[model samples]
Target chain A: MRYALRGGKRLRGFLVLESAALHGISRAAALPAAAAVEALHAYSLVHDDLPCMDDDDLRRGQPTVHVRWDEATAVLAGDALQTLAFELCCDPVLGPAERRVALVAALAKASGAEGMVLGQALDIAAESAAAPLTLEEITALQAGKTGALIGFAAEAGAILAGADRLPLRAYAEAFGLAFQIADDILDVEGDPEAAGKRLGKDAGAGKATFVSLLGLERAKARAKDLVTMAELALAPYGAAAETLRDAARFAIARQS
Target chain B: MRYALRGGKRLRGFLVLESAALHGISRAAALPAAAAVEALHAYSLVHDDLPCMDDDDLRRGQPTVHVRWDEATAVLAGDALQTLAFELCCDPVLGPAERRVALVAALAKASGAEGMVLGQALDIAAESAAAPLTLEEITALQAGKTGALIGFAAEAGAILAGADRLPLRAYAEAFGLAFQIADDILDVEGDPEAAGKRLGKDAGAGKATFVSLLGLERAKARAKDLVTMAELALAPYGAAAETLRDAARFAIARQS
Candidate 1:
């Protein structure tokens, strides 16, 4: 539990909880689903830190799971954490039986291999996606790696509130893209103190980043555009989606 | 679909369907659920064969995914396939609404990091798990690595059949152990021509096996005992579980 809470930005979890609230999903019911997504986010981080993968040693300002334990234990913890996410959703205390099922479906869609795992695979692929990629390929990579999880987070929030899925999904895709752009910006100029991850690693790793391919100014402008698109997607949602809209601005505007 | 049929031992999917049938599950609904489980099994094989992980060149006598395509595509395909498994279950036509939810819940439990992925992580860890493990540790390792997925498959079958879970789970555990034992025996006796894997690679890998630690005769005997135990666990379901009972025997008795 301590490990679960310590380091994640929890922006995704917060977005989920807040969006669920916008749709009038009760706080009592939203926490487990909220935490489940967080567990998945955490699981991805742990796995990314493996020696065979990203091989980072520090995360959330503490030793990465693989660093603290052996690579095997870290792998086990991540796997356990993933299972725990679904288990939490299955918890009977969350909501009505039907609501629980809907949330599970959305969460499963986001957390599985096709969603985030597929994205990770692509991220790995991007290292060799022919040096600089075409804009379309980069967009596809971000959508899979970063966007899919965020989209799921947004859609899951809507599912939590029993909200209609169309608008929720629209907001999800926009925000997911926006978040990745913001992440790209962070790689260029964000405060090192806050992200806990070293800056400029994207270039070092030969990863394709918005700034790397698009130039810093263009990338920054694109980030703003994505944020706008995200906010526009939620416009139909009105004040109920305030937190979501703010998240859009925060995605691009934040220092870290 | 044909690719799904042609590769590998049908052990996991078979165990699942038989257990479900034991609880009087109709084959019509169970077949797709079995396929869903099989897809997950196949996806895992695809990823596991990647150069970064197992690095095997052959799986069921075909070039492994990473070997056929680059690692990234293989990874992405695995992710896509995992999502496809859940998508298959979510099909509106698959079952009653209630059963669809159950299927999703079961798949989420089995395929995610907790079940098979966690097991694989441990398998990686066991590459050097503190000198030879105690028999107890070895059992725990096998349960996580091999037993969990098989157990998940069996339990899924039982659930798909609409069987009450209590009796189904007990048999699931027993068959899981039996399946692992037979695998260990195959490592000792099987020819690569028949087995479709590099024969005796287990000993060469320094990985502990039930047969490796115990004599071959003892391993074979333990497997038989496990099958009997599996049957006893299914006793409450009576004659309906005959396929499951026989499957446990077949699972342990098979040469390769």
Candidate 2:
């Protein structure tokens, strides 16, 4: 399990902490929620990299869990990590039981059938599909596969504070789309050593992506527009949300 | 997901309901918890039947998830099912947020590395060990793999009612061990048609089990003694727990 969680950009964890701070929630109180998102994200990556799934041998520039240990270990480790996510959310330091239960519910919805898992199933189905997905379809697919968890992370602080989550939700939606678009851009041009994994698998598999459907320049332009929208969504918090706005910009600018 | 859940005896669900009734928690309010345990059990079976895991082609008399669909679908379905378990535990009908969070925490601990997953990991490790597990080791392995969740199910009512759980926990531990011993007995002598899956796989793989270590007659006797202990554990609940007592008897008597 430690091997699977070794390294990452920790973007989702950052969202949880940043959003919590925006709501005036202490970093100490929000730490478990931050760790929960990272653990859950790690679980998804472990499973996605399984031999029966993407069959990748590299992740974060290290041997994948299945390659390092074995398939059974990878599966079990992923399963336990997923369970750990829920367990961490129930920690007492997260504040009231109501808040913790709320977090658990939101996390489950975002990561389960109606969210990430649905996105995965659709992606798998699309592989044997008669034609590549359209730009609109790809957006919808990414919304579930990646957008849901990101949205949950951003909204987590609001949930913890019992505040309205609409602002954070809007920010996450735009930011998540921008992030995916940037990922496509990175795949097309980023150095493999910097990205820490194979960069051209989407094209190699003939899969549709934002860049594939929108063209390189158009994709980059779309990402920029989305980042602006993400930044604007944080206007309700004024300068207090500057870090979040910077995060939106960073999403599109990061190499990995 | 529904395919994976079909046709089980639902002993875990029954335990949840029965235990809840013992604590005066109405079945209506306890239904989601009942469903949660069943979903979790189904998820475990689906993943356990994966090609890299147990590699079983059949479960509950039907083609296993991996066989019915494909490995990728099976993996995603199992992942979603596990997520569903957490979601179900958060159902508002289950009661206050405190109770729900408590349930989620207990469920996560029971199913994760400290419990069921640990047992599974130990089982896999034992497969390639220098020698077959000793009787004591096998007992310890089954305690986690099977006993943990069963204990959770049995204690869920007490949790819901904010009642003491020690009695139910004791009952469940004995019942779970007895159940596994009965399973080993069945594998040795039960009909494949009745058992709904391949029989004798443990012995075929040279794995140590209650029947192997204790001999058929002795194992049967041990299970009977366990049923008595399970029954005795329910003494505090008086006639209200008679059905649970019956369940203990049924655990050993059932063919499947």
Candidate 3:
């Protein structure tokens, strides 16, 4: 579990903390929420790298959990990590019980059948599919696979404060899409050494992605536009959200 | 997920509903929790049946999720089912936000590294150990693997009503152990057709169990004693807990 959690941009965790800070919540109090998102993300990655799944052996430049230990250990670790995510959300330090419950509910919605899992199932189904996914299909897949959790993280702060989550939700929708697009772009052009894992596997597998559907230049342009929109969505918070604005840019700019 | 949930004893869900009734909470209000536990159990069974884990091809007299579908589908379905458990706990109909949060927290603790997952890891580790587990070690493993969730289910009603949970907790501890011991007994002597799934696999695999460690006769005696203890623990509830008492007796007496 610990190995699966190590070495990531922690963009989701960053969103949780930043969103919490915007709602006048202390970073310390919000730490559990940040940890929850990261743990959940790690669980997804561990399972994703399983032999029956993506079958990846490298993650963050290190041997994947299944490779480092064994498949059973990896499965148990990932399952435990996922349970830990919900446990963390219930931490009293996170806030009132109502808020904690809200977090748990939102997290379940985002990560379960309705969200990330659905996206993954779709991706897997597409692998053996008769035809490559269309642009719209790819977008829908990314929305569930990546957009959902990011949406939860960005909206968490507002939830903590019982404030409206629309602005942050809007910001996250664009930011998450931009992040995936950047990942697609990276797969096509970035160095595997810097990426820490194999690149171009999507194309190798004949999987359609933002890059495949939009082409290199067009995909890059779309990602930029989404980042801009993400930044614009933060207008409600003014200068206080500058770090978040930078995060939006960083989403598409990071190499790994 | 639905396929995975079919045809279980549903003892855990029964405990949740029965306990809730004891606390004056309507079964209707407690339905989500009952569903949550069954979902969680189904998820565990699905994952445990994977080739990398227990490698079972059959569950509930039908093909296991991975066997019927594929490993990827099984993985995603299990993952989603777990998430659904937490989501069910957060159902508004369950009661106040505080109660819902408590359920989520407790469920996470019971199902995560500190509980069932830890027990499973230990079981896997035991498989390759230099020697078989001792009687005490096996007891400890069962406590985590099987006892934790039963404890949560038995105590859930008390949690819902903000009542003292000691009596119900005590009852569940004894009941759960008795239930597992009976399962061991069944594996030794129960008809495979009646059991609905494969039996004798534990002894076949040379895994240490109550029957293996205590001898079949002694294990049967021990299970009966535990069932008595479980029934005795419900003395405080009087006739209102008759169904639960029946459940305890049934735990040891059931053919499957």
Candidate lDDT values, in order: 0.71, 0.94, 0.94
| Per-residue C-alpha lDDT of model 2 across residues A39-153, encoded as one tens digit per residue | 9999999999998888889999999999999999989999999999999999999999999999999999999999999998898899999999998899999999999999999
DockQ, candidate 1, vs. native dimer: 0.31
The order of the candidates by DockQ, greatest first, is 3, 2, 1
What residue pairs are clashing in model 2? none
What lDDT does model 2 reach?
0.94
DockQ leader: 3
Please give the range of 10 consecutive residues that has the lowest summed lDDT in model 1 chain B. Answer: B71-80
Candidate 3 structure quality by residue, lDDT tens digits, B1-256: 9999999889899999999999889999999999999999999999999999999998888999998999999999999999999999999999999989989988999999999999999999999999999999998899888999999999999988878989999999999899899999999999888788889999999999999999999998999999899999999999999999999999999988
Worst 10 residues of 3 chain B by lDDT: B191-200
lDDT of 3: 0.94
TM-score of chain A of each: 0.93, 0.99, 0.99
Q: How close is every model to the real structure, measured as TM-score?
A: 0.85, 0.99, 0.99
Q: What would the per-residue lDDT of candidate 2 be over residues B1-256, giving only the tens digit for each residue?
A: 9899899899999999999999888999999999999999999999888988889998999999999989999989989999999999999999999999999999999999999999999998998899889999999999999999999999999988888999999999999999999999999999998989989999999888999999999999999999999999999999999999999999999999
Name the top lDDT candidate: 2
Per-residue error for B37 in candidate 2, Å, reads 0.5
User: Weakest 10 consecutive residues, lDDT, candidate 2 chain B?
Assistant: B45-54
